[model samples]
Target: MEAESREAGPSAALMSAIVTEHFVLQSAAGTTVSEALGRSSLYLSALSSSLIALGFASQTPGLLLPFAAAALPTVFVLGVFTMVRLVGTGVQNVLYLSSISRIRGYYRTLDPEAARYFARWGAGEGETDDALGSLAVQGGPMAGLFTAASMIAIINGVLAGVCLALLTYYVVTDHHLPAALAVGLFAAATSLTVFFRYQHRRYLKVQQ
Candidate 1:
């Protein structure tokens, strides 16, 4: 009986560990979908601002296609993302609606045992560590997301480097080192400010 109980403890822990990972994956997938949507929003906004500035449209509302080529990529990305969001839509729709009714009924009938179950599993922090924490501590989708963010940062760094090279060329060819310095400084400041503002907003949203 003692040996059997000891083995049972680890088995139960392993099951709980699986459940924890599931929720983390759900949260990450939802977050990734949200980020993709944000990218499309940014692209659309830039397109709108540039087109309006260029006077691409008339006062009428019935003519706008060739004038919107810049937004085509944004539309494509949104279409692909919409299909991705359809993944598991059917099951979730039913489970969610059904769970609403059944869970309410079950909630009304809860006893001490149900209360304790809620205490252990309601907010999803279990006796063991979260799935995202354990698996992604070393590497996984969370790490992949961080890796993606890092890659974006690296790309921006490379672009800044190219800008610096251009500044060097301008300084050498035009012999206008002062003007070059001003442009370079302004470029760097603008890039840094934009990057930090984006990161700041993202961090604030995550914290909230």
Candidate 2:
């Protein structure tokens, strides 16, 4: 009974996110909102799974207590808040781009003073302007944000899959739960450290 109830946690979170996304998309305009909904739905699913896993893992006599207090809101806030920020940033960028007449014109060579201001030493704004300016002008930020959200979704799904595999091992060969914990922790660590940071870190590295 505890296991069965705990299993419902992720499912509830998933349904909540999907409904929320659907409503948000209905009111928002442009591709950013659509992309955001897509990304949110994916992240929500992953977090929901994690929520369910954690809840079930805690399978005490009263599983719903843990899920209500801990699991559901954690997944909801993490997924929704990030999506909201990304979408807001995307909309602001679109508005900024709309202000300028010629994106190409903005590429006018960066003055030495401006280079010092931006600390873009040896970096060419004539080329980078279009790319980076997209943060304020084009959909580049949205695209990049989507990529990050997608990577997170993939990471969670992979972790869940690893857990399933470990469970299979335990059932098939009677291995202890330690095997599952080790594999699950390894995947969690990699997901948190690698996939979460990969894009942002790589971007900074490239800039430097």
Q: Please give, for residues 1-208, the per-residue lDDT of candidate 1 as tens digits.
A: 8799765544657546655655654565556546655654554465456447436554546333333333433433443343233322312322332233333334434454554443322222321212223223222223222433333333343335335544454435465666656665665556545544554444333222
Clashing pairs in 1: none
- For residues 1-208, could you state the per-residue lDDT of candidate 2 as single tens digits? 8798765444668556655654544344345556666776666686778767766766676554444445544554565456445535444433433333122232222243443333321123433344344443222223344553544545454544455445545554477666666666665566544443544443443233
Predicted structure with the largest TM-score when compared to the true one? 2
How many backbone clashes can be found in candidate 1?
Answer: 0
Task: Give stretches of model 1 more than 4 Å off.
Answer: 1-147, 164-173
* Cα shift from native, residue 109, model 1 (Å): 18
TM-score of each: 0.31, 0.35
Q: How much is the lDDT of residue 120 in candidate 1? A: 22
